[model samples]
Target: MKRLCTATLLLTMLLSSGCENRPKQYERTQELFGTFVSARIFASDEKTAEAALDAAFRRAAELEQTFSPTIADSELNAVNAAAFSQETAVSEEFSELLGLSLRYSQLSGGAFDCSIGQLIDLWDIGTEQATIPTDEELHRTIHPAAHEVISLQDRSVRFTDERVRLHFGAIAKGYIADEMKEVLQAHGIESGTLSLGGNILTLGCKNEDEPWVIGITDPFAPQEITATLEVRDLSVVTSGRYERYFEENGVTYHHILDPWTGLPSDAGLASATIISQSSVQCDALSTAVFVLGAQEGLALIEGLDGAECVLITDDGTLLQSSGMDAYHVKQVEK
Candidate 1:
C-alpha cells in the first residue's frame, strides 16, 4: 500500500542520470509477514549485496516465525496457549517484545493494546470471513486490562485471566524492520532502504547530500499523496483505517478497534503517520495516535523528543505536529 510520490521519483531519476558514481542499487522483494517486504542496498558489487540482502530477509523470516500469532509453534502462540493455566517461560526476545508492548499499552491509557487477539479473531477484518461481530460477541471477547492480566518476570510471561490473548500485529513489523536494518549494517551497508509493507526505514541518507523522500498517502484517495517528507536515517510508519476494512449494509468498518469500546475506532481521523528514529516506536505510536485522534495524538507526538506526526482527519484536513515542519517539504494540493 506504500507509494513513491512524484517528488521522490523525480529525485531518483535525477540522481541516477547525473551521478556517475552512484553505487549499484540492488533490491530484493518478497512476501513476508503477510505483506510485501523489500530491501534495497547500494553496494559496489552484486555478490556482497545479494548476500547482505539474503541475511536481512532471513532475519525477517526468523522474527516472523517467533512472533506470528497464527503460526502454530511461535513463542507468542506458546505463551497464549499455556499462560491461560500457568506461567509460561518465553525466549528473552519474546519477553522483551511483550514488555515493550505492555509499556505502550499503559502509555496510551489502553488506547493501544497487544491483548486484543480475541477481538481481532472475532472481527476478522482482512480475511475472507470478515464480518461485524455482534454486541454480545464483542462484550464477551474484549479485555482492556492487559496491563493487569499480563505479567513479565525474568523473561517469563504469566496471565491472570484465562482468556487473555497476545497479538503483536501492530508493532511486530516495525520491530522486524529494525532488525533487518541491523543486519544490513552488520554487513557494512551504510545506505539502504527497508520497506516492510508500509513501514519504511532509511539507513542513512539517500546519498551524501539528499535525504530519502517519503510519501504520505492520502487516506481519502489512496492513489494520491497528501504530502512528502525529506528525511534521513528515520522510520516512517503510518496506520490508517483505509488499510483494511469491510463494508456491509452501507456501513464501513475498519480494523483499528478501540480497546475500551471493542469496536473500530472512529476517532475523527482517517490516518496517523509517525516519524521516529525507531521503527518500533513509530509503529506503536501510529496506532496509538490513530486511537487518540488529532488533539491528543498531536500532543503525544510533541511530548516525545524524537517523534513527529501527520494526522489526516476523516474530513480530509491535514494536521502536523510542531516538530514536523523540519521534515515537511511541500503539501500536495487537492
Candidate 2:
C-alpha cells in the first residue's frame, strides 16, 4: 500500500507552458491527517501560496490518514481487519468511498477490484521479496473469488469472505485529486490545477487565456513527455508500469496486476491515460485498461460514452480513442 501523505507540498507542475495569468495567492496546506497542516495558496507574495498549500496539504493528509490502509490506527484498516461489527456503524464518508470502490468492481468486471491486497503482498512487487508466488499461495491470498462475495446494502458494505483483501492504491490518488479540486472550488478558486502524485484535475481554464496543459509521461523514459493534453474542468488519470517495479534477473515486474491470473498483465500497452468527468471512474478505468491490455482495453474505451483514452503500447505504438483525438498530444523535446 502507498504511504499516507501528510500536509506537504511537492511541485507537481512542469514546463509551465508560459502563461502570465497564474494564481497569485495559490496556497497549499500540509498535514499528517488533519493535524499540524501547513497551507500555501498562491498570491502576489510567494509566501501566500505556500501557506495555502500548507493548509490544503494538512486537510488532505487528515483525510488520507483516516482512510489509509497502511495506518494501523486508521478507520479504513479497522474495517478491513473487521474491527467493527455492524457496517452501518462506520463513518458515512468511509461508507460512501467503499460503495464507490464496490461499484467500480462490478462495473469493471473485477478488473479494478480493491481486494487484491493479498496478492500484492505475496509478490511484494517493490520489495526484495519480489517474485511470483506459488499457485496455492496466490489463490489463498489474492481476492475477488467471486462477485457474489461482496455485498453492499444501504450505504454499508461487507466482504463475506475473510481471506479477501482490498487495496485502493490503484484508484486512491485520482480520487484524492478530484477531492482536492472540490476543495479548491469551495474556496472560490476555480482556475487552477490540483495534482496528487501524477493524477491531475484541472479546475477551470487558466484565467480564460488557455486550457490547462497536462502531460503524459513517457513510459520508456521517465523525464520525457510523450504527449500533452489541453483541457479545463476535467480530470486526467494515467496508469503505467514504468515508474514502480522490480527487476529479477532478466524479467521486469511492475505493480499493475491481472486479477484473473494473480500476475502482472502483458496487455500489449505500456500505459493507458483516461479522461472523464469523474476522477473516481478515471482511477478505476486506468486500472481496468491496464489489466485489459491493448485490444480489449481499447474496445472498453470505445464502448463508453463521454469517456476518452490514449493508450501507448510496449512497442512504441500510440493509439487514441475516437472521441479522445482532440487531446492527442505532441511530444515535447526535453
C-alpha TM-score for every candidate: 0.92, 0.83
Clashes of 1: 0
Residue pairs in candidate 1 whose N, alpha carbon or C atoms collide under 3 angstroms: none
Q: After superposition, how far is residue 95 of candidate 1 from its true place, in Å?
A: 1.3
Question: For all candidates, what are the clash counts?
Answer: 0, 53
lDDT digits (tens) for residues 183-253 of candidate 1: 99998888988899889999988866688999988898888888899889999999999899999999999
In angstroms, the error of model 2 at 93 is 2.0
Candidate number of the best TM-score: 1
Model 1 lDDT on a 0 to 1 scale: 0.88
Candidates in order have lDDT scores of: 0.88, 0.71
lDDT for position 126 in model 2: 68
Q: What lDDT tens digits, residue by residue, belong to model 2 across residues 269-326?
A: 8999999878877888998998888888888878888778888999978888888756
